[model samples]
Target: MPLIPKSHPRAKSLLIREKLVKGFDNGLVAKEGLLAQGRGEAFDYLLGEKTTKSAKKAIRAAAAQILLAERPVISINGNIAALCPKEIVKLSKQTKAKLEVNLFYANKNRKQAIIKILKKSGAKVVLGSNISTSTKLPRIDSARRVVDKNGIFVADVVVVPLEDGDRTIALRKAGKTVITFDLNPLSRTSQTANITIVDNVTRAIDLLIYDSKKLSKKNHSSLRKIVDDFDNKKNLSENILEIRKNLTRGAKIA
Candidate 1:
């Protein structure tokens, strides 16, 4: 096989892997995060590393849901912190949502590193810094349990980028409207979320910020309808079909 040039689509996926590796070395991402990135890259490659129409609709619906919430929060993990800190800041500002760090493999050093990164990204009110004042999120026994009282604990809606399945389920059981950005549409995080943006976080965050502003002027009823009409199973099937189409085309070309 010939070498993939830096400009190639496969090379872009490799660059994403490099970012995750560097993030882990910098103590901003967990070891498991590297494996997660590899999994996401497989889906990204199959999708041609581009967002689809179904994903666009889901992204807009997620933005609408965030705008309609009384108290919205944007949850950040180590991977998201390393990948899209500035985008997260912009999305939080645009949607008036709280920014909170929620790591699965929690440690003081890693948490502080992510907090510092977000603060430098112009985030003024990043929460979850004080784990001492945490409220129990039922069904979650991991470090994801220790959310701040004024953040995820009280949020009516939350956007979880690079989310884990258990935390997503716990948040829903707590009565919060969950929105997730996961490349794997079949993942539990995607299935459990009220609105799933089946796209890369690097792409989804920026689009969400833009779409939220565009949809902000919409009335409450309109936004509610957007949420109500969302069908996760249908959306997942759409993504699966797209993947199959790409595979079939590649086979024919070969």
Candidate 2:
């Protein structure tokens, strides 16, 4: 990776790209993951490259849901492992949520690479490595359907950052509450998820961890109220409006 000057206008974005490129070289990210990151980056630009109020609300609700859940699992992919492995591990510890590596482009070496990163980041037990213990998710044919029986398969709530659409729908059908971080509010993964934080995962993940810690001290009923008060569709609509506002503002600036 090249040296990215902190004073550079797109410093954060540039650093994220470099990280993904390095992850690809390290076998922690697939070739397709680079392309996916590009798409999400475009949306992040539209979002003004910051976490919005709607995103914060969704993050709080997601945190509450995780705390209230009997079994909550955070599904990690190659990009997540490369980008924020330490934050992921912290959130897992804070929320007591299980960490499971699930990928669309699944391979043994890639899986091992991700697990190695997570463990190095202080994760004690990362699931989804052994195929013998894996179970198939209903209504999805993608490689992401192969889930560890003790993790996602049994989880009451799932935190899937940078997730695909079909699996979000499938998880819902399987009777699990799905929470996701997506830059594009209009994407299927954003729309289908029970709680969608339409923000950059790198930024929103830390907030989720913070909220998880704060909400953990509250009673179950208080946490339940936060979850009950959230409306995913409404929040998504607000995020869309935010994009429209940003476009209009940019046009005016031009």
Candidate 3:
């Protein structure tokens, strides 16, 4: 597809859809991922497709958590693997975190497809197919209930971009620090996560990678301080306020 001019009415939205279509063709995106993207797109549109200040703070905190963890694992799902394969791989390597695949709609073919995509993106290890070593996450009835023993199950911290709500709650209950990129601040995933980044996944992941690298040289105490200082509720409140303010301003104009 040729690049759409920035002046086009729906340039950004079209481009995002284009990427998803390509991902579907590559088998990296599930059929349901398209619907998930639609839901996310609506939220993104509400945010004006812009990363707010609160979202950046959440990203920074998320980075600190990943860096401070003894074992950090980056959990990738169909949407994320299709959307930010290279950046996700980069983050895993940069933070020395394990790259793992966890799917909502589990299937051998889709799982393998995500793994192939990650490997092609330079990921050496993508851990999803170890049902023999599956560990249960409590209170989740979805496919997310199962995770790899060496991956998310044992990690001190997990970066789960575009996560489902129940799994977010379950991981937290399991004592793993959870970081999520969710555009909707009100969603259970965002409110329950230790660090909720209310931003587009593409933008949020890159920012997180940048922050992780910059914070990598800092001492452990400093990284821990950053994490400790973060308040997920306050950050999410700020995001909601911004959304409300924008909506109010639009209403006044109308």
Candidate 4:
């Protein structure tokens, strides 16, 4: 299908629907793809396609972390581009993070799609991946097989938008800090990320950017410790229990 006209009034929705098609083809996505889309749309609406309180915190923390890094790379995937290409570009400017395409379905066409959107949004970084992309820094994991790359590889921080567990593991092994957005706190991506914002991407990204605008060059060492201290499994269980408890109380009230 032709690329959706980004300038058009319905461009955002059109892109969202198209990415859903690509997401299903990628196959690693959750089984409830349609349901997820509906939920994300609702979240985008609630957020007014802008920032939220929690998301604002997340963005500030993320930008501060990246700014502290000697090398920061923002990993852009199809879903991220489709959802918030403009914001992604803004983030690249804010954090000085290189925009790189790292998706489950890495290919020529996919790279082109990523580049098209980023460039359209005025992001300066060229197309690149774990396998082949021009970088003075050495390649760590080519062919997308390895769990991690080893070296002072030019990315101390990696913002993995729309990520999963496998690559998140790789980033950890590489000693690179990861910031992610995940609604299902139980997912591996959320569990492994150094900073996990448990919310929809549109809301999360906007908040992060908003905070990015306000945050200075100061580091967030204390916040990093908090994030590290939180256990993924425990956090997920707590979230689930809270939801269940609230639902049970609501049932009693009814």
Task: Looking at model 4, report the run of 10 residues with the lowest lDDT sum.
Answer: 143-152
Give lDDT tens digits, candidate 3, residues 1-254: 66889999888788878888888888878888899899988888778788899988888888888888899999998888878899999999999999888989888888999999899999998897877888877778998888888988899999888898889998998888898899999999988998999999987888888999999999989988998999999998998888888889889999
Clash pairs, model 4 backbone: 59-208
lDDT by residue (tens digit), candidate 2, 97-191: 99999999999999999999999999999999987899999899999999999999999999999999999999999999999999999999998
Where is model 3 more than 4 Å wrong at Cα?
none
* Worst 10-residue lDDT window, candidate 1: 1-10
Cα lDDT over the full model 2: 0.95
lDDT of each: 0.87, 0.95, 0.88, 0.63
Query: Which candidate number maximizes TM-score?
Result: 2
Q: TM-score for each prediction?
A: 0.93, 0.99, 0.96, 0.68
Lowest lDDT sum, 10 consecutive residues, model 2, at 208-217
Give model 1 RMSD, 1 decimal.
Answer: 2.8
Using lDDT, rank the candidates from best to worst.
Answer: 2, 3, 1, 4
- The per-prediction CA RMSD against the true structure, in angstroms, equals 2.8, 0.7, 1.4, 6.6
Across 132-181, the per-residue lDDT of candidate 1 in tens digits comes to 76777888898899899999999999889889999999999999899999
Residue 226 in candidate 4, Cα distance off native in Å: 8.6
Q: What lDDT does candidate 2 reach at residue 167? A: 97
